[model samples]
Target: METAQENRLNPFLYLTYLLEKLPQLPDPQDEKALNALLPWSPSLPLICRVFTPTK
Candidate 1:
């Protein structure tokens, strides 16, 4: 992380790298709480297809 800061790495490129490196869990059985943090959106990909429409 220090190296990235020192080298002035591009923020977008760093974000892409971080996304690619993140674990892609198929199941949301243990992710209900985290899922609650993300608001449903038409643009974001349907990761676990667990969208709860607002009433």
Candidate 2:
């Protein structure tokens, strides 16, 4: 059975789909280096943070 959220168009789902089509990412430990190399591009956790609602 599909939940309400699943029925709706979710940004996370789209992001996941796009990510799945991309090449494999570096190790989590390399996040800092990745950030330095591509400040404009956000990591998975950072992407989640942007989508999350702040209290």
Candidate 3:
């Protein structure tokens, strides 16, 4: 049996795995379909923060 500490996974590693599996831009329109295909979705603020220019 694995210990809790041993079972722990790095969030950044998981995020990288998820991003690699996600569809390219111009995804499906249906929310259900999108959710079914995507492991995660960033909120509007998070998306804006990532793309927004740094001054």
Best by the TM-score measure: 1
Considering TM-score, which of the candidate structures 1 and 2 is the better prediction for this target?
Answer: 1
Residue range 1-55, candidate 2, lDDT tens digits: 1331342324565357445633454564566654532323334334322344579
TM-score of each: 0.30, 0.25, 0.29
On the 0 to 100 scale, the lDDT of residue 30 in model 1 is: 47
Q: What is the lDDT of residue 47 in candidate 1?
A: 47
Which residue runs of candidate 3 sit more than 4 Å off their true CA positions?
1-7, 24-55
- Candidate 1, residues 1-55, lDDT tens digits: the string is 4443443444445445446534454554546533432333233333423335689
Model 2 gets an lDDT of 0.41
Residue 47 of model 2 has an lDDT of 35
| Alpha-carbon runs more than 4 Å astray in model 2 | 1-8, 24-55
Best by lDDT: 1
Root-mean-square deviation (CA) per prediction: 15.0, 9.4, 12.7
lDDT score for residue 32 of model 2 = 62
- Cα lDDT, model 2, residue 54: 71
Better of 1 and 2 by lDDT: 1
| lDDT tens digits by residue: candidate 3, 1-55 | 1221133433444455446545553664667545543323332123212233579
